[model samples]
Target: MSTARDVPETTGITEPPRATGLTEPPRSAGVTEPPDTPGDPAPAGGVATAGDRARPGDAVRWRRLSRRMLVIHPIQEVVRSAPALIGLLFAGSSQGGHGHIWSLVGLAVMLVVGTLRWFTTTYRVTPQYVQVRKGLIRRRVLTVPRDRIRTVDVTSHVMHRLLGLARVEVGTGRSDKKDGGALKLDALYAPEVDRLREELLHRRPAAATAPSPRRDAAAEPTTPRPTDQPDPLPVPGNEPGTEIELAALRPAWIRYGPFTMSGLVTAGVLAGFVSRIASEGNVDLLRIAPVRQVVDRVGHEALWLQVAGAVAALAVFVAVASTFGYVLAFWRFRLTRTSGGTLHVTRGLITTRATTLEERRLRGIEVSEPLLLRASGGARLIAVATGLRVGHGAQRGGSMLLPPAPREEAVTVATRVLGTSGPVTAELVPHGRAALRRRFTRALAVCGAVTAVLLGLWRWAGLPAWTWQAALLVTVAALPVAADRYRSLGHTIVAGHLVTRWGTLVRRRVALDREGIIGWNIRRSFFQRRAGLATLTATTAAGRQGYSVWDVDLGEALHIADRAIPGLLAPFLLRAGQPSDGMDPDPGTDPIVTSPGA
Candidate 1:
């Protein structure tokens, strides 16, 4: 048994085997046999030998992951230096020669710290699993069991491509919030990463020693099939390639352009703008300029020229920022799939990031069709998962799988990857009377504030405003209530999902699976009692972008309340002792009785 005490000191700490001058012989295409056993050890030479001889349930064979290493984007070197670089540039431009003195100290500290970090970071793989342990002060040790491993993503940024390195992210399901549970190993040799992935995926399943099915002599086939002909098919789960086709590739369009390009650009532009802003002395050209110098250079007669020059400079800054943004966003976008059921995503202009999500962690699917994308017949798909934030932040992360795909292709991918069919159908409950009233009142408050601000501005400018801010506010305030009365929508649970749709101009349709909901709150006010409406807010553990489904009929609220707790609590109680059936009995036509936390 591999116990904690037996864990070798070099387990995840020692450097990996150095790459040998090696190459694999080419093979002609055909169906290939998987390793016979899952625990088959790796060969002494680089090529992994898929296990074919071991019995099922045997101890996992351990083998060092020794293959060519790859590094992530080299630009990460510059990106990591952003803080010190900005400090240096600021010091150089601001304090004449004095700032340069401090800049040297800053640069020295950064170089020492960064170099130490580079040498200390390390990762390793064996037949059983992949392990990563790094961090100078708060050391982190992450071990992902091979079976639990879902996706292995390898990414190469421009720098990585140049240096033949890649960043590898191995995603297990539901990472712990505090620890950043997902496994990350950066700047590894590319070939080594690929070999590790192959080891994870290809090492043969430990062959089961279980007795084979017996056949009567009379029942056996009279003769074997012709040598070139196919053999008799094995039963379900008996054979590997019997039914599985290499999971079809996500369509080409989805893998390229759109989401990939957009994500890269967005991250790039952000990184560039942040780098520039941080580099300068936090100056905003729009608000502050070298006014005295500008006036002196062009002379007092051309006053407009000074203002124009300022505007041009701002424009130039924005233009340069956007270009850098585009370069970063579209740089080296890639999406690939492994033989195992996992999707890999990698791309970055500066600091590279890779993400892998197992098919099982996927709870719900969201397909977004922005106007521009819709017109171009392109759509983006996002998977709502539990625990992990979508990605870097709420805005970009929730998407485990993103490939700009056409509408039909997008829907197809959703079905194949998430087991969802077509678009999720959700009931649209229009904002109820109280809810509408609240929206209208909120709108009115906003309008009132705007009207007051405009009136003050009008006085200050000494100009008569042509628009009636008061009237505009009132009309806007009244629209929600009217929209509710006329076009109000409400929803009901359909096939274990809560469908919510509410909005007039910017319509939104959100569908959340029942299992995806982890928590909820239902509230009603005095005014709501008279209107016969209540608010129900449902919460999901879906990554960091927690979802909320709110404001529906009081009857629906009650039904949700009735179902939520019993359903959630039943499984645990069953594990202890079977509970009575009434715990979550279906509520037939009549509204369910109100309950809290079930």
Candidate 2:
């Protein structure tokens, strides 16, 4: 149970001498000392020989991936497309002729591609850069500087686990491309993957110095170290630096899963899947014994009662399924921050995953509360970091700091991760009443349009009378939602952070570092202009790129922008009478007063 701190630091370990493989050019036939042998000492002026300067292991060397990759490649390719392959076989059998031939052709093509990929791709690790050379026809070499490497991710699926192999992905935090700005080396041995990760992430010590030939070896301590000296206690893998366990999945947290919209989405997908299967097989789902029994039982009830019962049943089923999915995905979840400034998250039941997020790339933290979860005092925390793209595979949960945790816990985790003691989710500045009016008006407009559509259907398309009642109920429900949305809209500047809060169904409060803000965008639509409101967007290199503070007064928006980053917005601000850089505008006067359209 010894931790990293319990492990004694061993000292006086010398680095192995590097091999240079370098030799000085043959000395010109000249006056004095015979051409210096490799062992021979220095020239005049204390000049060191090339052999003295050459560091061994510093050369760029190309290395092919593990040979096992050749076999794993086609197997993985086939596994990834197994569903499609099965579908193709089924369709071919049904069609009875050339379909089977086409399926075979597809398999052949896949095998050929996998073989070519295994043969053509090669990578090299150098002191300055990591280089990948790939392609069969159009040769390409991709070189990423060592300093630019942001994240090193190692992943292993079931097949990889069984074979003791893993995939290594190196990400640079730039997500402008479809590949999520990553260089992938697939199917490396597990140990090799770990070694590569360590080599890439290890920080060289600043005090490391090159070996000096001038130093007297005899002056160094010659006393032989005792071989019997006890080796330092092994550090626990999970205990690196000052590790703090922030949160872990609990059975109670599963209840929050049902409150999310994911349940409804899952239900819809399930319904669609059943319908597709039934249609394809020419089977009547309603004729199924259970379905028929349920239908018959519900048919005796009143129409309204029947609809309500079905809706309730669907909701219950969805909630249960969502809860189960949450459990399956996060059975043993743990979030920890290491002293080395990396956030380590380990989760999953069947396929355990470990993700590392460097603190230096983290720009902010977001606290999200879905309506139902918020009502139950639960919220989720997400990190707004640069390298962890929000939607990439395996990385989808990379930003998630805490999942459906208590609101209080979420706030606490945010504060700790952000390295600030200030109110992480407090002191939010509210929008003016005009924003409320705008929201209410927009809600009413939507309700009115729906009602009009329902009435038109009833009059011209013979729709049922219940449509009118449904429209009325929807309109009534929208009012409170609009009011809630207005209440949720707010922004605040605290301790060099710009916090923007908005949304009703999924309320999000983001605390972004003010220094990370690269630019500001002021947008005003015709309606927003008339309402004297504008949306100010802060653009950064991390997390969604641009986050907006919506529906604030125009003057207030400018003021916030100016205060958030002084010189950036001041040049664009219009002053009274004459344009002056240093002069402060009168507090009573609106400096940029003009028409709403302007």
Candidate 3:
């Protein structure tokens, strides 16, 4: 019954008392277990179920995180509580040094709280679930089923690397929700982290079904990874099969960074900070000596020249900021695959991230081409997978497949990742003339309204005639944009994926696995109803939760839905000469069903 091998610490394990329901296990000095209530409901943090307690037959050996955390935690606490500490310092300064004593007291409190985490937080990988018990005042147990595990992200920041530790985040189907992150181990020994990640992702279910929790303090899970299985990550030597080199960072790609417009995010943050400081100090930015000098010089320039100069200055600033940000974020970015049926992403110059995505969980990918990036022949790639969110501007979170690079490199990487160029490069079927009309009418209508408002202002509000003149220029500008939007509109079924493309400024082309779709939604607007066009939404339990195919011919939309997930809308569709479920059609009200399952 002794399962501990090369794990001297777990060798001294004693099984938990069944009568108490996971109350506490034997621990070393300075380690304390949180009190467990037998009949309480599970806390907000997810544990499989309170009822799934350890059985008498199972051995639950609780273990602590890396002792180095005793140092890391306090530093993290100080950083998180910086504002509060600063406020206290100010108050103490105003209170004639009484704040010094309070500051000392605050430091003591942080030390106690930070130290307690090393004692109170204990995790265990049981046969059925991976669990972490934390919190001193409000003891909570969080867990996720090993069977449903979707991803295992092992990250090591600069501090973590220096400390020889790494954080392990376990992602499951349910763990992808907003309330996820319940199953994370802040920092563990680097060796143990790798072992746990390997075991969790590469072991067979039958191999680890029996819970034998006797393991050393720094030991990995006892479950051995199947030799036949591929390594989740392509380590230097233990690669199971020939590693397929997908894409790697090219030094020249840095030139494309500025075109990504990622600098706008930095500009926004700086602008907000400047505005806050200006407001607080009651200072006028325009009144500043340097600003005034520039203003005076510009005031003498022609309007067009002034505008051009301003634009040029802004562009230069953005380019510099964006290029710097890009270098820091994707310094050594790489994407690769293996015969192991996994896609790996590793990047970051300072805070390194190594992510492994099971090819099985990968539904598809999205190719994003922002206006500036597109104009510069650059693009980025994001994963569209279960339990992974689509990252917003500048920050890809953990879903980035490729950083902003040449569009050709992006497409090449995407094609190899998905195992086919048909989904990545295939020409999509165009939506009919109705969609073209819909796209243009909406754009023109908005432009017309703005122009009319400006014309009225010029006529009655004593505004200069230039107001209407500018509106006319805008109306002229709208035509090309409207055409670009129409050109971006396309959809088709490629291989087993439902390919969709739409958008203008930040264009996204997504190729989603049809098998992942759970339901179909058909939405037709008042104008769309008249124009005989409908937007079909493909609902899935994955990225974005829902992907919409906007502005498609109503009949073709239905056909696409049927083709995507055959018979999903069969029950809700109208039969020739027959009403649908006693609901009349064409009653001047558009028919829309949100996720009508067949």
Each model's lDDT comes to 0.48, 0.67, 0.71
Q: Give the lowest summed-lDDT range of ten residues in model 1.
A: 25-34
Residue lDDT tens for model 2, 173-292: 675645425777875777666556544554312122332222311122122223233224423442233446667777777778787656676788988999988997789988899999
- Which parts of model 2 are misplaced by more than 4 Å? 1-58, 64-72, 95-120, 134-140, 202-242, 286-291, 296-301, 391-397, 456-465, 574-598
Model 3 lDDT-worst window of ten? 1-10
lDDT of 3 by residue, 392-503 (tens): 4425447789998898898999988887888879998888888888877888898888889989988999889988888889888988898898899889998889989988
Residue-wise C-alpha lDDT for candidate 1, range 1-598, written one tens digit per residue: 1211113335533223335222322111011212222222333222212211131111122232212221222234446876877767676767566666666666666656655555455554433345665657655545665555555566666666666667676655554444445577665566555545544543322331231112111122122122232224323321211222212223354333432234444556766986687556565444435755655566765768777887776555554554454345434544444334445455556745555555445556666554445556665566666534565732245253544556666666655554555334433545556666666655666676677767777778654674446546565756654454334345555556665544443233345677777776656676555666666676675653344334555665656545644555333232323222223434453266556795
Model 1 misplaced regions, further than 4 Å: 1-79, 82-115, 126-130, 135-151, 172-179, 198-339, 344-354, 369-378, 391-400, 403-409, 422-441, 449-492, 502-508, 525-530, 544-546, 560-598
Please give the lDDT score for candidate 3.
0.71
Per-prediction tally of clashes: 43, 1, 1
Clashing residue pairs, backbone N/CA/C < 3 A, model 3: 10-215
Q: TM-score of the candidate numbered 1?
A: 0.58
lDDT (C-alpha) at residue 393 in model 2: 26
Local lDDT at 11 for model 3: 38
